[model samples]
Target: MVQVAGMNSMWSLILQGDAMTKCILIFLVGMSVLCWSIALYKLVLFSIKNKQLNQVVQELQSVQDFKNLFAVAKKHAKTLPGYFLSQSLRHFKELLLLKKSGKQEYAQGAGIDFLQMQMNQSIDEILHQEESHVSTLSLFAAVSPLLGLLGTVWGLVHSFLSISQKQSADIVTVAPGIAEALITTIAGLLIAIPALMLYSFVSSKVREIEFQLYILSDKMITIARKVIVEDLISVEFDENFMHDQLDRE
Candidate 1:
């Protein structure tokens, strides 16, 4: 009941603010709404993706063969790690086909470097795509307070002008202006604090996701290397059979 009264009083103060103060308050409210909406969206998205990534990581840990890894990758095809895994596997298959056809040597030398570069490029693209809209939160957090301060200053200036015009310094004349100034100031802080906090939290989550991507990249490279090494050994031991099998596929 007490809290309800306090909220009502705050709303009353907001309603009594002058035109410029009202505009500033409205803008602050809109910014707060957007900030919270984005924050909730990003938080939920990150949570779900993080869970998917952990699942992929667990599957990767138990995967003993390329076939099993490929299956795991396909299962989580919508996730970041799954996307990377699938792309890397596709590139590996292409390189293997080229090697078997005697058109490219992917198991060693410059071929391996090229494959690594392609996989890294794919990882970078996915990372960029996953990090969208993070900057908007930071922008709202940083700008809201300054806008609120502008409103407060505007209110104070108007208050001073009103006092000068009246040729008197009375509490009744000064109170409204002071109220407007305080309202704008409070409105600004209300928008800024949560925005700033969410921005920090979201940024840290993004960084953690990025770090997981790097780990995924390393794991993918390791798997690719192992597959290529085994394939190279098999081809060396039975070039004709391997070429025939690859050609038939």
Candidate 2:
């Protein structure tokens, strides 16, 4: 009689353990699907953005007139790096006006000068715009692993309590909770790994764009100084604007 009772209890424990393993498998599959979907979407978006930006940079280097620059950028705004181009055009317009007024020094100056300071400020602003929404990827990557750890701890606690009540050290009594705990840990890695990869990819993309922006700013300053030195044009508003702005300094 005693042997039969022990065998029946073991069978019951085995059935419970099997059900818990199924639950863990289902949880892992669902979590993996969600993480992969997000990563794929971001990958497509970044790839398209980078390709279009290269084309826009090529067009920018070839343009000589402001009207032509604006026309090219506007036509490709939907697919190209329109935001940075738009910003550079606005700054160029300001510099052109300063050159017309013979205040070229105010429009293009040395690294430690006021005009150079303005260029740095513009670079910062453009970089900030490019980096928008990237922090979300970093946040998700950081939180997923911790969430997995939490689930692992919860499963272990439940398994120990079950073993105490059953008064036996059988795998049948403990396997379910242990499997569920491992499922959470695996789920967390599924969420974290790809997210970190995407974050690094996007970060590098932003840095490349920033380097281009800085180089373009320096080129604009050099071009303005050259035109002024050669007497190509005299700016009408140069006297009043330069004196007013510089006097405030």
Candidate 3:
């Protein structure tokens, strides 16, 4: 009840503040709203992607060859890692087609290079998709404190202005205006602290996801190289195939 009355008093003070102070407060409020919205959405998205990546690799133990890997990825096409593997396999298929067509240029190592480029492009697209809206959190964290300082300075100006208008240097005349100005500083700190935390958490999660994807990509490329350079798939694709394939490299 006391907190409620204090909030009511604060609101009344805010309403009595000058136009510039009100505008600054309103902008701060908007920034907090946007920051929270993006933070919540990204947190949920990162959580899902992280969980999917955690299990996707274990599922690979059941895969036999590139074809089997592609099929498993197809089953999980909705997941981030699944999409990555499928895209990588699609590019690998093109390379294989060119290689089998007896194209001299492809046999000269151009197809492998093309596959590498395509895999890199695929990784970048997915990472960018996950990294969206994270920078906005950083922006809010960096700007909110400065806005608060600006409010603090403006509040001091308000205090002096009040004294000049009243033609008396009385504490009671200037205190209200000064306190209102200081509210902006407090508001700025509140937003900045949480924004910074969210930025750090989300960015760290993205890096972790990227690391997992890189591990997957390296394994996939190794398999592709062996298949293209040595023709391993022509041998056997039993349950022991991937275990042997990965173990050798």
Candidate 4:
């Protein structure tokens, strides 16, 4: 009833606006749609990833050895933590092979440093993948308001021109221009506010994900150091034993 009539009147007012105003309205509508779409998609993605991360972290915490960690990571390979663990394990194996092949230069301090660098790179790549398209939301937030302001200025100029041409400042002559100006301004605010809010929310979530990744990376580094140290010690002991046997012969 009253709501329907109001809705019809609002549409009629928008229709009566100038071409520029109409175009601005259409652009704003499209931007609003895009903003909501990105927000919804990111929200769902972050929610799922966060859940997976928590589960993997819990499982990882219980792991006492690298073998068990690698196995647990294999089962959750689709998740961020799992991907990191898998990559770390791969590098670990490569380092072990180098050590066994008598590449002492690489198997000692240099090897651990190389593994740490690889793990850091892995974390960065995963973070980038998780944070894709978030910048678009920030861009929309900044641009929507400017576009709305452009529409508002255009409408005001038209209103003044109409008043001058008609030689009358009557309510009838002024109302349409004022309506057009306000509509575009309001539309812009609507688009900008939600976009800004969603951008903030998504950015915070990305930071949280990054923090978790850093924690996991630190834990992996600790494990890598321990494994490399033990391997080096075993190699040194084997070499000493062989030398003693050769001397006795």
Candidate 5:
């Protein structure tokens, strides 16, 4: 194949390059590998979590009361909303107990504040869990280009030194170093271009996820506050519902 010959020719050219060129190329390649690996991992992770979040949100839509919502939340305890709901419900129960102890006024004000605080902490935990390795992608995008530029500068300096030693200027003498410079520049761009794109893409995805979580938190806090302060029915955990949900899962 023509492609095979081109490949061999490129490989030979790379082999002909000096030690610095080789190292730069290798470092660029490694960054590219790591960048792509993180991209793939983030893509898969967000995809799965997004699907799960959507499913939970959809199920929550059909929930009419605190008890049913609590049942659903317990069913998907490992999910984002599920975990947050569990934390919220614990404070909800505490508020109820305090109210029964003749602390109704305190429960109305302090209870809602405490629940929101717990949910905020839960949101941070979720974001931290989902945002792993995103910074690494951005770092590689920034660092790769600089490394490539370093190689190019080194190659140019080497060529000038070579000319001084040989006391001549010609294509044959200059071509190898020029090619090495070009190769590093090309390698840097290759790594940087995709890395920048991946960084932007994953970063946007995370922002969107965070936005959704905030909206969901607001709605949950509003509903929970009403249920607590207005003495409305609250989510009551049910063992039979849990068993049924698990069976469906």
Candidate 6:
């Protein structure tokens, strides 16, 4: 009778251990699926953006009218960078209008300067938009391991509680709580690591495209300045020539 009771107790302990391990396994698998899906989605999105960015730059170079640029941006506004590009284009148009109207005081000399400032602002805004959801990835990655640690702590607490109640301790009695505690911690880390990796990779790609955009923006400003200076020079020459003609007459 004593031997049978001991065997039954041991068997019950084993069953409990198995159940805890299975629960942890299920939790880890679910977390892995969620994290991996997020990573893969981000990967595809960034990849598409990187490719489209080249096309966008090319389109900007060929664009003679700001209106066309706005239209293009509107068409692709669902994309991460597209709305930002649209905002920049709209701002550029406003600057062009200011130049044409020459309404404000100091509009002539400071026209290009104001446009440059607007350009810089627009770039900053675009970068902010691109970086919007990226921080979430980093947060999840950093938090995962801590979650795993929480599981471990919980398991330890449960183990102590079990020992106190039963007045006996063994691997069979202690391992279940430890295993359950570990499930969440492992799940957290499994969820977090890939998210961080994907965030880093995508951020690099975004920065590269941003660099190209800055270069292109600079080139555009230079061209605009040259055009304005040449126009001013031509006006000065025409006025001088007309004055001479009048004096001769």
Clash count for each candidate, listed in order shown: 0, 4, 0, 0, 2, 2
* RMSD of each candidate relative to the true structure: 5.9, 9.1, 6.5, 9.1, 3.9, 12.5
Q: Report, for every candidate in turn, its global Cα lDDT versus the true structure.
A: 0.74, 0.61, 0.79, 0.79, 0.78, 0.60
Please give the lDDT score at residue 213 for candidate 4: 77
Runs of candidate 1 exceeding 4 Å displacement: 1-9, 103-106, 230-249
Query: What digit string (tens of lDDT, one per residue) describes model 4 on residues 64-94?
Result: 5566666676677656677677667667777
- In candidate 4 the C-alpha lDDT for residue 95 amounts to 80
Q: TM-scores, in order shown? A: 0.84, 0.67, 0.84, 0.86, 0.87, 0.64
Q: TM-score rank, highest first?
A: 5, 4, 3, 1, 2, 6
Candidate 1: tens digits of C-alpha lDDT, residues 1-249 = 999998897788778778888888888899999889988999998888777777777777776556676677657755667767666666666666666787544455566677788877876776676668777888887888899899989988988999999998899999877877877778788888888889899888877777776766677666656656555332122244224333432
17, model 1: CA deviation in Å?
A: 1.8
> Please, what are the lDDT tens digits per residue for candidate 3 over residues 133-226?
8899999999999998898899889789878888987788877878888899999999999999999998998998888888778777777777
Point to the candidate with the largest TM-score. Answer: 5
- List candidate 4 segments past 4 Å from native: 1-8, 232-249
lDDT of prediction 6: 0.60
- Error (Å) of candidate 2 at residue 174 is 2.2
List candidate 3 stretches off by more than 4 Å: 1-8, 62-64, 103-110, 234-249
lDDT of 5: 0.78
lDDT tens digits, residues 165-243, model 2?
Answer: 8897788767766865666677678777887887898788777766666655665555445544444543233244333
